[model samples]
Target: MSEPMSRRTLLGATAGTAVAAATGFVPAPATAAGNRVPAVVRELDAKIEEAMAAYMVPGVAYGLRYRGRDYVRGFGVTSLDDPQPVDADTVFRVASTTKPFTGTAVMRLVERGRLDLDRTVRSYLPGFRTADPAASARVTVRQALNHSAGWLGDYFLDTGNDDGALARYVDEMSRVPQLNPPGKYFAYNNAAISVAGRLIEVVTGVTYERAVRELLTGPLGLRHSAFSLEELPGVRWAVPHVPNEAQTEIVPQPAAWAMPRAINPAGGLISSARDQLRWARFHLGDGRVPGSDRRLLSRRSMHLMQSNPGPGGTLFVELDGVGVTWLLRPTAEGPKVVQHGGDWAGQHSGFLMVPARDFALTVLTNSDTGPTLLDDLFVGDWALSRFAGVHNLPAVPRALPAGELAAYQGVYTGEQIYFDGSTLTTQFEVVPDAGQLSVRIDGTEVARLAFYRRDYVVFPNPDGTVGNQRANFVRDRDGEVTWFRLGGRLYRRGAEATVQRRSSAPATLPRPILS
Candidate 1:
C-alpha cells in the first residue's frame, strides 16, 4: 500500500496520469486490513501517486488482494480519443508477464515427458537460425528463457520497420556470434521467448499463442484475455506513452514497435484486473485456478520456473533475475516476491505478489510512459520501505562481490536490457536531440556496456561504467577473469571499443564467462 493523495491533486499532476506499485512474487492470500490502511501503506500510496505525476500518466488501474476478499480501484480515463472511466473490467496487455503462461505451456509437455529441456533449438524448430552455425548449434529453448541465447536486444538494432525487415533482423542476429554458452549467463531475448513459444507449437501441434490460453488461462477461467488485437476485449484498455527528456508524456505513433503479430510470446497478452487477480492467486497458493484439480502441473515445476537460473552472480541476475519473466525480487519483509510490468502505446501495466503477507497488487495505466512511471513508484528506499511495511528481510544483497562483478565488467549487448545492473535499458529511454541513447549489443557487448545515468557533468562516459563506477575482477587458474566472469562469452567490440581497449588493457582475458 502507498500514501493517499486527493483525486483532484492527481488529476492536475498529469494532463492526467498516475502510477501504482507492483509488489513482490509468491504472494499469500490477502484479507481486509481492517478498516484503515496501516500508516506504512498510506505513506507508500502517496509516494506512488507522486511518481505517477512525475511520469505524467493520465490514468491508472490498481488492485489489492488481502486475506480472502480483494479491493480493486481505478483512476482517470481508459482512452484518450474516446475517454471512458477504467475499472476492473478494463483490459491491459500483460506483456512479458506472458512468460509465465508460456513457461507453463512448455512444462505441460515437460510433465508428460514429451519435451526435454536439454534438447537443442534445431531439434524442434529445425531451420531456426541467423546463418551463424555457432549460434544455431548453441541456442536452445532453455537458453531462450534464461536469456543466455547470445542474441542481443532488438529494440536498438532494428525497428522491425516492415515484416520483411523484422524477418531479416531475426535472421541477421542468427549470424552473430553468441555472447555466452546456452544456459550459462542470463541475457534476456524477447525473440528467444517467442522462439520458445514456437517450440511449444512444434511439440503440441497447436499454435504457441492458443496453447497458452487453452492450457493455462482457460483452466484458470480467465474470461477476458487474448493475444491479438482482433480477438481482444472491448476498448476498455489503457493507452501507452513515451516520455520526453523532461519526463513529460507524449503519444507515440503506431509503428513496428506497437504491433503484436511479430513477437507475441515475448510481451503481448491483454488481460483485466479481475482476470489477473486470479492469476496472482495461483502463485498466492489458492491453487485450483477456480476450476479442476489438474494442478495444471506441479508445484515443483512452477518453483523451478520461478527460481533464478543465472550464472551464480549478481551481474547475471541483473540481466535476468528470478522467475521465468519479469523478476522475483526480494522485499524488506523477506518475502519472495514476483513481479512484471508492461507499456504499449498509451497503456502501462504492472503486477506483483507478496506471498508472505498474503497480498498482491495489479496496476494498469493509460499513458505512453505509464509503465515506467508506475515502476518508479515501486523503487527507491522510502518507496520500497513503506510498501513492504517493517523491514522483514534478513538483509539486503550487496551490489555483488566486487571481484566477481569485475569479471562481469565488460560491455553486454543483447536482445534487450530491462534493468541491466541498475542501468536502465529497455522500456525506459531518454532520447537526446533527434536520436535516443538506445544501444544494440551482440553476444559480447552485454558485459562491457553500462547504461549512462544522466548527470549535468561527465555525461555518456566513454568507459562501460556509468558514473564513476567501480568494478572487481575474479580470475581462474589462467589468471583470466574473462571466462570466469563473462562465462567465456566472446563479445566483439565495434569501431568505438576496438580502438579504446587497445589503449587500456589487453583485449583477451584468459577466463571465460561461465564455470
Candidate 2:
C-alpha cells in the first residue's frame, strides 16, 4: 500500500480548477453556470485525492453530471515515469464499461424496428451456437444483453483484431458449454455479450465498431472514445499498473496484455472522463441527443434499457437486478441507481448514475487497486450516500453457532467450464476452522467463508473487505447438502469418494455470478 498523503499535499501538487462544459456534443444546457466549484464537487475532489495518495494510483480522471451541472477534473500524473499530469482529455481503457454503449446501440436498433430483443442468436448470427444445440436456439438477444444466456461469461480468447473479430468470436462460442438454460439464471457472461455485439453487426449490416460509432458515440459527439487504441492517436492515455512481487509498489504492465481487441464490444473502448459523462447524460436524459431535441432513442426504449427485467438476485449489497446492460440497484429513497464498472488487466473504471436525481459519476484509474478505491472511497462511501441517499456501511461478519459450522465441512465437486467450452471437474473443500470456515480449491485457500444469510455464505472482496459474491448451498429431498451455486453456476457435491479425492487447480478463479 502507498503511504497516505494529506489533502493539502494533493491540492498543492496536482489540483486544478474545475471547468464548466456542455453536457454532450449537442447544445442544450451548460453543466456549470458559474466559475466557482460546488461544495459536492469539492468534497468529491478531496476524496479522490485522498484515495489516489493512499492507493498509489498513478492517475485518475472523473466527471459528474449532477442536478443540471457538469464537473470534470483530473488528478496526479498519467504515469510515474512520464510525470505528465492527467486532465479531462486523458483517455483510459473503459473496459467492460463499453457494454452500456453497445446496449444503447442495440436499443436504438430496437426503436428503429431494425432489431428485436426477443430474437434468438441463431436468427441473427447463424454461426453462433453453444455446446448445447437446444440452448443455442433458445437464447435470445435480450438474454444476451442481460447476461442470462447462461453460458460461461469469462471467455477471453484473442481472436485477431479486425472487422471480423466479433464473427470469429461468435463462431468460437459454439464450443462453450451452456451453464444454465436460457433466461433461467443470470451469469456475467462476456462471451454472451460479444454475441450481442455480433447481433448488432449482423442486424445493421455493418461492423460492430462502425455500428457503435454510428448509433451511439457518433451521435453523442464523443470525441475521445473509440473501440480500439488505434482510433485515438496523439491523445494522452493512462497505462495499466499492477503491484510488484513485494506488494508494496506498483509497476506498469505490458501494453499487449492491457485489453484484447477481440473483446472490443464486451470491454474494449478507450475513453476519457469527459466523454464518459456525456454518455451518462445521454442515458439520464431519456435518449435525446444532448444540446438538441433530436432523439437518438425513443424514451420508451431508453426506459426499457434501464428497467430491471426480473429478480436476478443481488450482486453487491444493494445491486438488485440486471437491465439491458445496466446493473440496477434501488435506493432507499424510491429511486434506482443504475451503474456499471469495467476492469481489464489493471485498469479500473466505474460509471454510475442516479436517474432520479438527474445525476451521474464516472471514475477512471490505471491501477489494479483502482476498483477497491472506487468502491471504498468513492461509490460505497460517498457517492451512494450523498447522492443516492443510501448510507452503505461495511458488513460485519456474524459468528456462526459452534455446531453449525460442521455441517458445511465437506468436499464438493462441479463441472467448471472454460471460455472456450472446455470442462474440468472442479473440487471445493470447506473445512471448519475456529468458528470460521476456510474454502479450499485443490490445495490453495480460496476464501474465508462466513454465513451472510441462512443458506448463503459470503466471501471477502479481493482486498479482504466484505464481498458481493456469495455461495448458496442447496439440499436435496433427503436434507443433505447436494449442490452449491456460486458465480451463477451450480456445483454438485462429489457423487463418491473417488470424485472427491480427484482435485486439481482451477483454470481461473470463480467470478461473481452477476456483473
Candidate 3:
C-alpha cells in the first residue's frame, strides 16, 4: 500500500480554479429586467470549491433550471497536465446516463408503432439466448429497460468500434448466467440494456448511435453531444482524472479515454453541462422538441417512461423503483423525481428532474472522487430544497443489540466487472460491534454498518453526512443470512477464507474497489 497523503498535498494538487461567466438558457423579452443569480447558487459555488479541494476533484461544470430561471457555471482546470478552464460548452463523458437516451429512442420507436415494450426479446432477436434458455425466451423489452432480466448484468465485452458492436455484445450474452427469473428481482444490469440497444438497432435498421441521433439527440438540438473521441475535435472536453495509488493527489486516468464501443449504449455519450440541462429540460417539459412542435413522444408515452412498470428496488434508499430507463424516487415534500447518474473510469456525471416542478439539474465532473462531493450537494437539502422545494431523506442509522449484529458477522466474496471486461475479486468482512456492524473490505475497515430498519443497512460517510448508498442483507430459504447486496451487486457469504488460505504467497491487502 502507498503512504498516506497530507491535507496540504491534497489541496495543493487540486487548488487550481478557473471560474467562467454564468450563462442562462431561458429567454425572456429583451426589455424585461434580468434577475440576479440566486443567493443559494452563489453559496453553492463556494461549496463546490471547498468540496473540490477536500475531495481532490480538478474540474466541474454544472447547469440548473428552477423557478423559470437558469444558472450555469464551471469551476477549476480541465486537466492537471494541460490546464484549461471548463466552461458551459466543455464536454464530459456522461457514462450510464446515456441509458436514458437509449430508452428515449426505444420509446420513439414504440410511439411510431415500430416496436413493442411487452414483446419478448426473441420476438425481436430470434437468436438471443442466455445460459437459461427458458428464462431467455421470457425476457421482454420492458424487463431489459427496467433491469429485471436477471442475467449477469456486468458483461462488458469490447466488440470494436463498428456498427455491429452491440450485435456482437448481445451474442456473447448467451453465456451469461441468469441470476433470477425474468421480472423477479432488480439488479443494475448493463448487459440487459445493451440487448435493448440491439433491439433498437434491429427495429430501426441503423446503428445505435445513428438511431439515437435521428430519434432523440438531433431532434432535441443537443449539438454538443457525441459518442466517440473522433467527434470531439475542435471542441473543449474534460479529461478524466483519478486519485493516485496513494489516495493523495489527483492524476489523469492512465487507461483508455472511453469504454468499449459495445458498451456505448450502456454509457458512452460525451456531453456538455449545457446539453445535459437541455436534455433534462426536454424530459421536464411536454414531449415536443424545444423550439419546434415536432412531437417525439406522445404525452402518455412520456409519462410512461417515468412511471414504474413492475416491482423493482434499487440499492440506493432514495430510489424506490425503476422507470423505462430512469430511477424513480420520491422526495420528502411529496414530489416524485426521475433521475440518473453515470460513472466512468475517472469522470462522474449526474442529471435530475422533478417534472411536476419543472426543476432540473446537471453536474459533470472530471474526477473519480467526484461522487463523494456530489452526494453531499445534490441530495443534501441545500440544492433540492432551495431550488425544487423538496428533499430526499436518507436512511437514519440505528443501533442494534450485539446479538443481532453478530448474526451478520462473516466474510462475503464477490466479483466486480468493469467496462473493459476486467474482473476483481472482492471480499467484505462483517464483524460484531457494540451497536453496529464493523464492515471491513479486504483488511481495511471502511464503514460502520448500522441498521436503518430490520435488514436494511446504512453506512454514513466519514464526514457525518447521509445520502451515502444504503445496502441490505439477504436471507436464504432456511432463514439464514447468506448474501450481502451492496450497490446493487450480490456477494455470497462463504468460501472466501478458503481461497485466501490456498494461495501460495502471503495475502497482500489491496485497496477496496467498489462499483
Candidate 4:
C-alpha cells in the first residue's frame, strides 16, 4: 500500500525549492540548487508564446522575485509596425495598478500622523461633495481606499492637468449620483481613489506626483517609474495597440496622452518590469525602506492594509475579499495571495505577491488584448503553483434553468461609465439565445453572458482571449428584478416597451477610439 502524500512531498512537487528555501522546509542547495530554474524559465517562455499567439498582444515584459532572487524576461515586439523587441527596461502604462502605490503613500502619512484613514474626506478637502450630501460627508479616507464608499464610482471627468486638477475634480462631484450609502457596498471607485490622492497632496503640501516620488520611488530607488510619458524622456517604451475593425490585425495606438492628470493618483503610473518588481518586494518585505533599516510603514499598518474590513461582492467571490487597494485571495492550503490588476486605453498590467512564500510576479503588456494574456494565460496561477505551492483552480460557469434565464432578458438603462468624463446616459439590452445570453451596449453586441452562480452572470468577450467580467442582478422586496450591477454602477431595468422604443435612438456617448 502506498502512503498518502506528506505535506513536504506535496509542496516539493508543486512549488519546488522556491517555497522550500523561503519556509526553511529543507536545506538549501549550494550550487544550481534544488530549484527547477531551467524548468520554470522554459515553462514561462512556452506560456508567453502561447498567449501571444492566441491574444495577439504586441509585447509583454514580465518579472518574478522568489526567495530574494529575480528573474525577468521580455517577449515579442514593441509594436507590429515598429518591430522593436521589448526588454527588461521597457516601460508600460500600469493603469489602476497605481492604486496600491497611492494607498502605500497614504499609509506612510498615517504613520507620520499627517493623515487619518478614518477621517472623512470633507475634513481635509472641505470642498468634497456628492449628489448625496450626507453620504459624501460621512465617507471616510479608509472607505475610499477600500472602495466601500457607496457613491457612483464611475464618474470620470477630466478637470484639466493644472495644479488644481484634483480639487477641481472634487468640486465637480456634486453632479455624480450615489449608488449606495457610504461603506455599504464594495464598488471599485477610481474617482474616490483620486480623492485619496488629493488628500495626500493636501497633507504633504506638494504635487501628487512629487509626493509619490519623494515617498515611494526615491526611497525604493525605482529609477524607471514615472507618472507620464513625458517624464520618462528618451526611455524605450512599448506603444499601445488595438485590433482593427475586422479583428484580424492590430494597429498602433498613440501614447495615452489624453489620460487626465487628475486621475494619476488612481491609475496613471507608467513603469517598467524591473521597478515594479522592486515595488512588490517593498510590500513583501518587512515594511522598511529598501537598502535602509528605517521603517516606512509599521508592520501592523501593512497587515491592516492587507486585511478585509467588510464584504466585497464579485471580488469576494473570486479572491475571498479585497483589502485597502489590494485583492486578497487564499489558496486551498491556507496561505493568502495579494495582488492587483490594471487596465487603461490600450494597456494591461498585473502585480501579485505571496507574502507567506516571499514570492512576487509582475507583467506589463501594451495592447487592448493584453488583459486576456494576463488572466487567460494563467500567469499568476503558474507562478503561485510553481513558486509558492498554491493551486488556484480555474473558475467554471454553471448552467441556469431556462426559466431563470428568461426572467433576466430585458433592457436596462443607466449612465455610460467613462474613465475621464461626465457620465453619459447609456443602454444595455440582454437577449437570450440558445441557452446563453448576449449583452448589447448602445445597440452593439460586446459580450456573451453565462451563469456563474445565483444572481451572478459572467460576460466573456467575443474574442476567446479575454476572461469573464461579472454582473449581478438585484431583486426588489417582491423578488422582481429591479436593477443590475456591473463595473461598480447600478442599472435599473426599463419597461420593455419603453426600452424597445428607445433602443433604436442613437447613443449619447461616442464609442472609444483606441487612439
Candidate 5:
C-alpha cells in the first residue's frame, strides 16, 4: 500500500471586551491612547492569539486598510527551531493568492495589445492539449483565467528550477482528463493557471516570474514580494509549519519547504502582509501605480478584471462569480467584495477588498491549520464585517433522512500529477453516518457533510459545529449523482470495485480551500 493521504489535502477572530473575557487574552494598550488601537483591531489581536492557541499556529501577520487608515502587525515567532519574532515585513508563502497577480499580468498584456482574452489556448501555446483535444482547443484565455477550463486543477508537477519549468509543466497537461467541456463549469483549476503562465512566458519571451516582476510587482512597488528562495536570505521569512503526528503542536515541515517550480504561477508566492495590503490597495484604486502617475492598466481594464463575471458559478452564495482570477462576493445594497487566497503545504494567506468602501484585509499564517483563523477573522467575524460591513452568511444545515443522504454515498476519484510525471490517485468514500454523510479517504474518516441548501453541504468542524466553507454534489442531465465538487476540484464517481482497486493505495488529497 502507498502512503496515507497527507494533511495538506485538508486545509477565527473576535472583539476585544468579550473576547478577552472568554479567551483570557488581554490586548496590549496602545501607546498613550492618542493612537489607541481601534476596538475592532484590538478585538482582532485577541482573537488572533486565541486562534493561534486553538490551532497551534506558530506565527501570523495581519493587516487592514480601511477608509484611508492603515494597520499592519505580526504575532508569534517565525520559526520554533531558530526563532525570531515575526514583524510586518516577515514573508510567508502567499500560495494560490498568487493567482490575482497572474491575472493582473495578463490584464496588463491585454491592454498593451500583446494578448487577447478571447483567443483560444492553442493560439498562444500550440501544444496546449488535455485528454480531450476538442475541449483543449475550445478553451479560451478567459476560461483559463476564470477557471472554467473543465480539466484537472489539483495537478502538482515539479518541473525543476529551470527557466523552462512552466513550459514543461504545460506539456504534461495533455494527460489531464477534462471533466467538463470548455466554459461548462468552474472548478478551481491550478493547471489552467499554469497554462496561463506558460502563455505569459510565450508572449513576453521571458519566464513567468520575470514577466510578473516587470508587469505588476516591480511597477507596484511591492519590494518585499518575490517568487524565489534566493531573495529570501536578505529578509526575515516565516518557515512553513504543520501539525505533529499527535495533532497537538505546530512544527516546521521536515522536507516540504517550497513548492515545485512549475506551479509557481499557480500558488508559489512569498510576500509580507504589508506588501499584500499594498497589492490590495492597487486593486482598490484607479489602476495607477501608488505614488506615480504611470498606469499599468487603464481604469476600465481593472474594473473588468473585477466586474466581468464568468459563465460558470462557483456554487457559493457569497461568491457570486469568478472574474479574471478574482472572486466576487457582491453584498446586496452594500459593497462589492473582490478577494482571493492561497494555501501552500504549511502556509495560508488571504486578501479581501471592497473597492466602494476603500477597505481591504490581509491575513497570513505559518501553519497548515491557518484556515481556522481565517474562518473567524476574514470570512466569519470581525475583519470583514467590522471594516467593510460585509458578511458571508452561511446556510443553516438541516438533518437529512437516511434515504436522502444515501444518494451521496459512493466511491469517487481524484488525481495528483507529480513532477516526474507519476500520478497519485486519491479515493473519497462517502457513506451514511448517523443520518449524515461521512467522507473518508482509504477508510480514514476526514470530515462529515451535512446538507444545507439544495445540493450544497457544510462541513462540520471537529467540535460538531458548522463552518463557512461548503461543498456541493453535482448531478447529470438525468438527475443522477455524477460528481462531488470540493475545494474547486471535481471527484468523479466510479464503479465501487473499480475505484477500490485503483485506490488500493492512498495518495495526497486536494486541500479544501475557499479561494
Candidate 6:
C-alpha cells in the first residue's frame, strides 16, 4: 500500500504556478512522428484551481489534450490526511467509465460471430426470466446492451459483497414486473450491465478479466490500466474519498477498488490519467485500435454503439452514445461535440471529443466531490473558444414559448416524463398513464400537460427538473388510474383530479423526485 499524503507536502510540491497566458502541450516520446498542437495549458491550470475552490473539492488529477499533444495537472490532496499531491500518473477509481471496455468486449464477440445482437438472452444464458415469465424470454442482447430491459434499478439496498450476490440479484430481477415493454422507455440502470458482464463470461469461454486484457490493453499497449485496483510494482496509488451521509458521525470512505460485487461492468475500474489517454484515443480513431483492422468489431458496429437510433429509437444513459461514452452536441465552431462523465465512490471524471478538431479533453479526480472539476473544464473550454475566436453555442433552452404555453398544455402522460412539482411526498400510481406519467408542470399554461413523444423531450426547466424526474399518481386496488405521479414530490393535477370527478378522470401532474 502507498503511504497516505498530507496537504502540506502536496501543496508544497507544485509550489509555483505559471502566470503565462498559455503553454505548449507536454511533449512525449511517443509523439515523435504524431501530430501535436500547442494548448492553453497555463489557463487550464488556473481554471482548475478556481473550480476546486468553487466545488469544495478535496483533490483532482486531470489530463487535457489538444491537437495531439497532452497536458496533465493535479490539485488538492489525493488523501486528506497527510495530503498527497496528485500527478498525471496517479491512479483514480474511474467507475462507470469502464462501460466502454465492456461494450468493446461484447462487440468483439459480434465480430467473431460468437454472439448475435438481436438474439434473445435465453438463447445464450437460458436463465433469463421476468415477473411476466412469457415476456422475460423475449429480451434481446440489444435490450440488455441498451438497458431497455424493464428491470427496476438494482435492488441496491440488499446488495452486498459475497460469492453469489450477482446470482441472487438476477433471480430477484427475474420475478419483478416491467414498467413497460422492452424498448418502451429509458431508465439509466446498472444491474443489467452486471448481468451482461456475466453473460459475456459465459459466451467468451474466458473469465471477464482475461477477456478484456487480451482484447484491449494487450493489443493497445495500455500498461498502467486494469479492471482491478492492484498497483503496479513501484507505482503509487490514490484511493477515492467517498461521502457518507448515513453515519451518525460523518465519514469519508477511502476506496482502493470499486465495490465490485454488484456493479462491476456498470461501475468498477481503476485507472491513471496516463493510461486513460490511450482509451480516449482508441475511440478517437473511430474505435480502431492501432493496426489490426479494428479487430473484434466492424466500423459499422463501432458507430452503432455511439449513434442514437433516431425517433422511437432507444437512448438510455447506460445505453452508450448517451451515457459516459460520447454523444454529439452541436457547437458554434461548425461541428457536434461528443462527451461523457463518470462518477465513482469518491471520484468524478469526464471525456469530451471534438472530431472536427480531432481533440479530446479528459479530467479525473481522487475525491467524490470532484464533480466540481466540470465547472473548471467548461470555463477553460469557453476561454479556449474565445482564444480561438470561435463563439460558444447557447443552450437549447427547453419548453414551449411563454405565449404558446396553452398549445403545449393539457395533461400528457408517457412511460418516461420528468415532472416533479414542489411537494416532496409522492409515489407512482395508476392515473392518466398506464405505466409512467410524464407530467410537465407548465404553470405558464394554467398548469397542464400533453402526451410526451419520446425520451428526454421533457426538457422542462429546473423549476425542479434536474436529475431523475419520476412522476407520482395514485392507484386503486383494481389497478385503475386515479391521479398523476411523482414520488417524494407532489403536484396537484389542476382542479378536476385535485377534486375528484365521479372517480373516472385522468390525473397527471409534473414534478421531479424519486418514486
**Per-prediction TM-score, please?**
0.67, 0.82, 0.88, 0.82, 0.88, 0.66
Error of 2 at 428 (Å): 4.5
What are the lDDT figures for the candidates, one per model?
A: 0.49, 0.69, 0.73, 0.70, 0.76, 0.49
Off by over 4 Å in 4: 1-36, 245-247, 315-317, 378-383, 392-397, 402-409, 417-422, 431-448, 458-471, 474-483, 487-490, 497-515
Which ten contiguous residues of candidate 5 have the minimum total lDDT? 11-20
lDDT over C-alpha atoms for residue 272 of model 4 = 92
Give candidates' CA RMSD values in order. Answer: 10.7, 7.1, 5.1, 9.7, 4.9, 10.9
Residue 273 in model 1: shift from native, Å?
Answer: 2.2
Please give the lDDT score at residue 513 for candidate 6: 13
Global Cα lDDT for candidate 2? 0.69
lDDT at 281, model 6: 69
List model 4 lDDT by residue over 1-515, tens digit each. Answer: 11010000101112112211222222111112345566665676667666665656667888787766777777776666666667778888888889999999999999999999888889998878888888799998999988878776666777888889887887888888887778766666788888899999999999899999999888888888998768888878888886565545556886553578887888888899889988888889789876689778888989988885544555312455567788776576788888887777667887788898988889898877666567643333556788788865344566666787878888876663455564456566877765666666545565566766667765544343324345577675688877666644456787552434344532221221210
- Tens-digit per-residue lDDT, 100-126, candidate 1: 677667777788887776688778756
Worst 10 residues of 2 by lDDT: 1-10
Looking at model 3, residue 20 earns an lDDT score of 25
lDDT of 6 by residue, 222-337 (tens): 77676565535655567665444431111245643446454656666667776787677677676667545655456687677666631121121111224222334445665545
Question: How many pairs in model 3 have backbone atoms within 3 A of each other, for residues 3 or more apart or on separate chains, i.e. clashes?
Answer: 0
Minimum summed lDDT over a 10-residue window in model 1 is located at 1-10
Instruction: List residue ranges in candidate 6 displaced over 4 A.
Output: 1-39, 154-168, 231-234, 242-252, 255-258, 286-288, 291-296, 308-334, 375-515
What local lDDT score does residue 487 receive in model 5, on the 0 to 100 scale?
Answer: 67
Q: What would the per-residue lDDT of candidate 2 be over residues 92-113, giving only the tens digit for each residue?
A: 9888788888888888888888
Per-residue accuracy of model 3 over 118-195 as CA lDDT, tens digit each: 999899999999989999999999999988887877777777877888898888777787877898766778888889
Candidate 3 local Cα displacement, residue 473, angstroms:
2.8
